[model samples]
Target: MHRARLARWVAGSVLLAAIGWLVSIAEAQEGAAAKAPAAGAKGEAAGRRARAGQLPPYYREVVSEEQRQKIYAIQAEYNSQIAELEAKVAQLRKERDAKIEAVLTPEQKKQIEDLRAAAKTKRQPRRQAKGNAPAAAPAPSKPAPATPKP
Candidate 1:
């Protein structure tokens, strides 16, 4: 019983250390292309974040060697399929971005890049008070001209 507990602890510690090392290594190029995502890519970004934020299968669990081997076998069986699908998705995304970029004017492309950078800087949601009402009625957007048409 004591040996099993010790072994689990050691495994958890090693797992955490490896994850930390990977994060540290990835930090260098984390934002190389943070800006300039194609339109509707926000949903894709959120999906990626949701996946990354999920707990791993068998996370925080200690299992026997046989169970671990079974889990690994299952993982190995699916990993290749997952990799192939991921590569195809990446290729599709790249082609989609290229098509969109091709249609944009130089000025429009620059504006999109600037807007993307600003969006990456922050995501601030509008705040509403107790009542869902505007602070005040906006002035007439297009007031009548002072003089009538001659």
Candidate 2:
């Protein structure tokens, strides 16, 4: 008789656990289903904005398709120029450092190297965060024109 009672208790415990798990799964599924429509709407709105060239405020003056293309070209040109300038500056710094190293004590050279390393590390985190942050929100669209009288 005691053995039969123990077996029944074990069976009841297993059944309860299974039911709890299923209920939790069902709740999660329902929550996800409730959220999906809002998420889908947001995605569709973003798509429409993109198609309309409704970019962020910073780009307000350049949001038209033609203007955007021109801006891209200009940006590419500026990027190339900036890269070339940066390379030249780096080369100049290397030459200057070499000249200074010839005159500086070993301790002074080490200090300069430490400073350069510190600067590089400090800049890296800021650049990485900038890359990870969400894109800026787009500016509001212009009001629609009034319809003509019939």
- Give all candidates' CA lDDT scores: 0.58, 0.61
lDDT of 1 by residue, 1-150 (tens): 789757856865676566556654564355355545676775655454444433356653877656655555445434544565557557755775787598789999999999986664333222123344445433334579999998
Backbone collisions counted per model: 0, 0
Tens digits of per-residue lDDT for model 2, 1-150: 788757856865676566556755775677567655577776754454455433346896647777765655445434434555557557755775576488788998899899997776556655666786444433345577799667
Q: What is the TM-score of each predicted model, taking all chains together? A: 0.38, 0.33
Off by over 4 Å in 2: 1-57, 60-62, 107-150
RMSD of each: 23.5, 30.6
Clashing pairs in 1: none
- As for candidate 2, its clashing pairs are none
State model 2's lDDT. 0.61
Worst 10 residues of 2 by lDDT: 73-82
Which ten-residue region of model 1 has the weakest summed lDDT? 121-130
Model 2, C-alpha of 98: deviation from truth (Å): 1.7
Error of 1 at 127 (Å): 23
